[model samples]
Target: MPAFGRTMLTHWHLDPQVAYLNHGTVGATPTRVLAVQQAFRDDMERAPARFLLRELTGTFPAPWRSESRLREAARSVAGFVGARAEDLVFVTNVTTGINAVLQSSQLGSGDEMLITDLAYGAVTMAVHAVAQRTGARVRTVSIPFPPSSSGAVVSAIRDALTDRTRLAVIDHVTAMTALVLPVAEIAEVCHARGVPVLVDGAHAPGSVDLDITDLDVDWYAANLHKWALTPRSCGFLWARPDRQADLHHPVVSWGRDKGFLAEFEQHATHDPTCALSAPAAVALLREWGWPQVRDYIHNLAWEAGRRLTARWDTRLSTPEEMIGAMVTVPLPEAAGSTDADAAALRLALLEEDRVEVQLHASAGRLWVRVSAQIYNDITDIDRLANAVRQRLVVSSVESR
Candidate 1:
């Protein structure tokens, strides 16, 4: 977007004063895409029977055509990560997608599901619930701070792996720490030892340039609602086509006939507006083009990281190449990013700095994760950094 052209930003109606650095927290949809979605919703609402029953019919090809359009936006999503399109299925969000895969999979009493200590809390609960049902054990690769390399991540996960380990679930980017794991190497290690890898790429989709087909993980789930910058209910689970039979939907609906992908798309419909909006969201991204957008967002985030790194006590958790758009900066010991506190820093920044960010604790470290999108700029980062510096300085003296 051009600096002078009010047209770009005027396209959307976000609060002008709030510098939103938290695109990672359910993306802010562009006005154009959302407008299209609302139009679809309005059309559906106006003549519910016409759009839902008559137009959609029972045959999925028509609605599936919309998904295919979204898919064409990039098979690189799976391709880059090292998976095929046949292996992938859509869901409303990663939680739903991951839960579907976990609950329906054949994990049992003697089976174990491996995960990282750094995983998103909600996902951890989902994993535990499935374990509760199947009597599977939940083991984690404890990735403490000072984790130095891709090798370190791989080694930690490898050590956690045992003969009973049915699946190893790792994060492409840790939601709390913004840390990226060496999933490809770990995938290779797991595959060699007869374990399947499930990647939680909740933050990867539109935030980073992803190619799932290139990654060796047997199962990958991503939330288009988060980084993908699509609507709230868009997410996907892609499995190796061969493993497709091994997996089933968390919700058992009309999918026994064709395959898992069909199963996901045909999820029961009271009215399919939210899910149907996904194609329009994909269309918006295609219209904007990420080449310049990625570079722009990266530069802003990198500048923010540089600012955070300049502080004496603060630490940077994410590796350079690993974190393209999101950067995690460890806050001082006193801060907390969880909701009860309103994440003082996050709220203060939003209210005062007009800069929105996410503050959370992971690995015993408090952090503020910064995210950037087409709507963000360097000035926004500057605003956030300034507010953080000002507050921490006061906090420093209060501690004394």
Candidate 2:
């Protein structure tokens, strides 16, 4: 581990006994950020009525909904993502935000929703439901396993579109491949064709320096819990000012008519701890130099890819330029990268080596996905590589 990595690990509460490399699946909240969430939970529990009725609403005596603190937190998060506070609304996670947009949309026969083979499964399911209900079709562009360049990506999407293409749902950073898509270019193409774009950026917020406004996408949804150091269930949905009028909450509640922010803010009776602690999460990362953290993790991911590719005699799914804080490499054919094989390998790595990582069966092959966070260093990847080598060697022997 690098000296700087050692210093960063102290701030996180990850179990040292386990070599945790699956940060992309679900992020590990820093100790300080967790403490902030705990404080909010405690306040809510202290006086449920006072906190919910008076404090949360700031009503009755003052006639104001006491969401100023949460709004401020949203403002802080907006600043981090290069969005205006009014344009962003805090949601539980990216899935919910995408669902909200899809549900509000009007799809019908011959309508098309553009997506790729690399999108997250849950989001794909949501798109499916929307399509099924309205007789719309999901137009999928099969991005190459190892994309040649961002230009190829843009061209693929542009050529795939037709007059029926109503909306394009693009992944800013694909979950399976970990390839960072050229969103700004795609958005420009979609707009020129009179098609709106919804960017599923679940893994992009903290992994990359984002400017949602600059991307010019009609809608963008991201999960802060993935890489932004926010507690579980924290995410944000942003719609361009004009697009907001077309948006609606997934679950309509008492606040339906109270404008965009209010519609999503008071969805139902739920814990606000995650949303309330959002500002602290962003602030803590900022104080630690979020940009530096992003660069460090990115470098770690790239270095891990380099080492693993060299050791396993495999190639990366995409080039280093297309990757962010996570990278995926194809496992050797003899290693068995199927659904069952990937599951077995993941379990073996955890049980035999105490190494935590992610594996997915994609493109008819098994690929190992590793994530780099501040708590991780070269040593962690080194351990992971060793475990992988041992498992593959043992598997090869048994098969022979």
Candidate 3:
């Protein structure tokens, strides 16, 4: 309906001087969404006790309200993700939601928690912590990098599940690799082995069309701050109706015995504006038309991968179907192949070229993960391409 690319940059507060290709890392919120969050904060400060105790959670009755502000917001978000409000609750981020599920799991000495190597580092650490606390063990399944097909990913997880696997954690869209895993198919395989699935959908909400109900997983954790245009520190967890009874919030607070929604709603006092302002973010998505927005971003990301790989003389191993609004492309061998090299190259891109992107070393080569958003265009990709090439030339000269 409206123009995308630099013309759409007016809606966000991102610096014009920097070519930002890192939207998937920590999302950039739009100016309008921030203003809406500020309004909620202003209302909360006016009557702190009434807002927090009486009206925010609706656990206790308020004279003028039929539902809590939090539940109302949850309902809005649930609809967006094709979930029921009663089955979903807000958490600070994806890591928090996954931790809550991990802590509540019924595991014994021989039990195992299965996760893939592609999981976010924080999630991997959280699973390890749970295993340490309980007598359980963590088993990592390594999905082949630059996987040939989605079936290969599903098969890897299927082969990894065992009788001891009490839970299987998978990613809807991976972090470092930027591959969109076949979660539904993977869930089917895990379910056959009687293993419950928990999906870390951190990069999924805004990047692709999502329906939590269709995923067939026991639990789904995702962020609204990243692709959904919400302010920072807003994420949600969705549980099947049958799974809710056994789940507990990570923080034990006033609503301990109350239901799943109540347990998460009263997880100690913290800023609630990020969650409260989520409805505004959903509204913006509707205004833009989700399909149009998704397509524009996905196409741009694919184009970026194509152009960058061709320019760098490297290959894009992941197929287009497995990519969403972000794609990971390998850098030339000249970029170096260690974590330190990746870090130094990233810093150079930012400091020298004002082009910020996510870089990591994987499969014996340096790779750049480019995130395409509504405010980005081919010019940004060209900037990144030119900058990296310049670095390669400089490296070649110095080495001789």
Pairwise TM-score winner, candidates 2 and 3: 3
Instruction: Give stretches of model 1 more than 4 Å off.
Output: 1-8, 54-86, 256-258, 311-313, 333-342, 362-365, 395-400
Scored by lDDT, model 2 comes in at 0.87
Clashing pairs in 3: none
Q: How close is candidate 1 to the true structure, as a TM-score?
A: 0.86
Model 1 Cα lDDT, one tens digit per residue, 73-191: 33534443345665766677788877877876787798899988888999899889889989999997788754677788888888888999998878898886676677789899898
In order, the Cα lDDT scores of the candidates are 0.70, 0.87, 0.93
User: What tens-digit string does per-residue lDDT give for candidate 3 at 267-380?
Assistant: 698899999999999999889889999999999999999999999999987889999999999999989999999999999999989999999998788999999999999999
The TM-scores of all predictions, comma-separated, are 0.86, 0.95, 0.98
Residue 29 of model 1, lDDT score: 71
| Candidate 3 local Cα displacement, residue 326, angstroms | 0.7
Task: Please report, as a residue range, the 10-residue window in candidate 2 with the lowest summed lDDT.
Answer: 57-66
1-400 in candidate 2: lDDT tens per residue?
2344745767788878888999999798988999989998898898787666556534323345545656777888999999999999999999999999999998899999999988899999999999999999999999887799988999999999999999999999988778889999999998899999999999998899899999999999999998998899999999999888768899988668677877787668888789888888888878878878889989999999989888889876576779899998887777785899889989998998998999978767889899998888899998988888888788779989
Task: Score residue 95 of candidate 2 by CA lDDT.
Answer: 97
lDDT computed for candidate 1: 0.70
Backbone clash count for every predicted candidate, in the order shown: 18, 3, 0
